[model samples]
Target: MIRLAIAISVVIAVPAWADIAEPSGFRGEPYTAPVPSTLQGAKVIDAEMALTLWAEDAGFVDVYPRTLKPQGLPEGTIWQEPRHDTIPGAIWLWNTGYESLTAEEMQRLEDGLASMTRGNPDMPLVIFCRADCWMSWNAAKRAVDLGYRKVMWFPGGIDEWQDALGPDLVRAEPVAP
Candidate 1:
């Protein structure tokens, strides 16, 4: 009886100790964690390869989320919006990389992608965020799902680009949807 009771207790406790299952869809929070080496439909590239693509005028999309002003600050608190710096010509598609997307967010992503590709699904599109961040992975995966013919994922992102190419970046704002 004691053994059976212990087994029951353990079975109940196991769930609490179990790790969260990786979603078959989009990845959720803790977006800064390490990601898989490959994104099934996209070509995963390193800094050198990304540099080559950049030189060739491949469209780049930065998926780093913008920091919005915090709400509920004590009255008269100064809130400065944070500036974002990205690849010289990359379009910033803010907040589209999150796991959950509202209708507006989805439209923003689609519109930004269209603007980047200029209505040519066959155009080479490179997607990225910071190194080891899953936002880039999700964004790259989304590009593939959106039927982009040529999707290259720079998993190393802006940091790697700067490290390899002498720190060239430009301040960017999110493209209007």
Candidate 2:
């Protein structure tokens, strides 16, 4: 009888330890559907702008975070070409893979942004990773924190872009140089 009682207590205690919530609050922030003026405050660009930029070569800066990971790739490989095509003149900023980020990865992201911005305080930049992804959310927030006056967040990332443009877009090969 005592053994059974102890087992029940152990099971109850285990759940208490497992109930800890993630730090970002409710799986990070709430995400609204992409809109034109979504980046009004932080200079974020949504999927629509990314597509438009790809088609028209609009002069918006494209950036990605380290935490954003491609759907499938070998470990330690920072960037991958989208299975579908991407916007022209887009640049990859590998901070880390999807799932979680470490302090070192965040630092690398900050350094990358500094290099990309190149002291252009007024430079407008767009950052993305994947659709329905929290990495972009966290990355966008980081950009804002870094004092990027015009930062756009492409929530759809590559997924929505491929879906919208179909074959019209061009896919690039991942190069290691």
Clashes of each: 0, 11
Tens digit of per-residue lDDT, candidate 2, span 54-154: 45543322333323355778878778434533455555545432344567665666666666668664566667666655556566666776787767677
lDDT of candidate 1? 0.86
Question: 1-177 in candidate 1: lDDT tens per residue?
Answer: 999999999887744334444357899889987677777888989999888888899999999998887889999999988889999889999988899888988898999999889999999999999987888888888889999989999989998999997348999887765
How many clashing residue pairs, candidate 1?
0
Specify the poorest-scoring 10-residue window by lDDT in model 1. 14-23
Which 10 consecutive residues of model 2 have the lowest summed lDDT?
A: 25-34
TM-score of each: 0.83, 0.52
C-alpha RMSD values across all candidates:
6.1, 10.4
lDDT of 2 at 8: 91
Where does candidate 2 stray beyond 4 Å?
Answer: 1-40, 43-45, 54-88, 96-100, 166-177
